[model samples]
Target: MTQFEALPYRHVLTVPTVPTAVRLARETTEDVLTELGVNPRHPTVGPALLILSELVTNAVRHAAAASPQTTVIYAAGEDCLAFGVHDRHPYQPSLYGAATVTEGGAGGLATVMELTLGLGGTAVVRGDADGKGKSIWITLPF
Candidate 1:
């Protein structure tokens, strides 16, 4: 394994649920991926960033009322990159089922599932201990 792959890295950013959060999250994710020694030009990284942007956009759009703020997370190790978007809304949607949750097979969550699975990655949701929130995490190996 490369030196970077042998080391663990992580970052988290919590921001107000607003339209600007999408851009902020995407930019920060790219920066964080660089810090984790991930190649920006990598094919999987592009789709991964797109997936993360969609997740943050979804939170800002749908959970803004109950979740005034959303968190973007990044963690990497063992030659894999992992990240997630967390909101204070209690509903934890399944990424697999999200494919059919939207009309015409087009939605943030649906697209996330498609890209993640298509890349041989994994996506799952983890509920907060207090049960008032959840985090949707995606892990992709580069």
Candidate 2:
């Protein structure tokens, strides 16, 4: 098998469901973005970090009740980067009617949608095809 067959993707990172996982998520994502020559100071970078932060936090908080293990996430693609986080819960998260700057809670999906849209990309979440859990994903053009 060639590299594409052996690896199939570019990067993958996982962290246990803990409070500090948000920081780790941001750091790891920034590292990958930098490795791909994306400037850390770019305006979009901060929102991307926030997207990851909220999504990961939700995974740690609401994804699973019985056994919330480490959150599994990966970033990969050719012309764009896609970030996906899989939590242990299968129930899909509900998005609020609308998002606003004044709102402050239960905005994970809304936040991800806005950030991805701002970056000229898309975000989506669905139940895992394997019927195990759910994976929330965001894709942005480089």
Candidate 3:
């Protein structure tokens, strides 16, 4: 009889703030998830990669000024997978504000929020140790 393990896995990867960072993060995340027993063809992989790409792209595009690199933290629990992107940009977005989705599909955070919430998950921001940066964490329950 095959039984499922409830062990959790976590990985943190830091990459230079460049256009290629998006691809790097995605590849690493896929490998890590697979190593942790997630099927490579899992349904969550698609949305998870999209969220990671968006987060890394935002860091590469907007935070390069104060943050030369971005850190991606990937964690998976018994029933959820979580990703957090950290940068020293000092600007914490307002999660309390109305959703950012537009009629014609304005991407980025809006898309992230939609996918995250649709998965019955939660998203929150965590400040860096030095208080000069923030990490946006998206946790989706499977």
Most lDDT-accurate candidate: 1
User: How far in Å is the alpha carbon of 50 misplaced in model 3?
Assistant: 0.3
Provide the TM-score for each candidate, comma-separated.
0.89, 0.77, 0.87
Among these predicted structures, which one has the highest TM-score? 1
Query: How much is 101 displaced in model 2, in angstroms?
Result: 8.5
lDDT of 3 by residue, 69-131 (tens): 899987777778887899999988865342476688756887777777776767888788888
- lDDT order, best first, reads 1, 3, 2
Considering summed lDDT, which 10 consecutive residues are worst modelled in model 1? 1-10
Give the range of the ten consecutive residues with the poorest summed lDDT in model 2: 1-10
The digit string of per-residue lDDT tens for model 2 on 32-139 reads 887877778877678878888888888778754733564545555555667777776767764433244344553667677777777887666667687778777776
State in Å the error of residue 142, model 2: 2.4
Q: Using TM-score as the measure, name the better of candidate 1 and candidate 2.
A: 1
lDDT of 1 at 13: 97
> Compared with the true structure, what per-residue lDDT tens digits does model 1 show for residues 1-142?
2232244787889999999999999989888877766778988889988999899999998899999999987878856888879999999887788866465657888899889888888888989999999998888878
**Candidate 3 global CA lDDT score:** 0.81
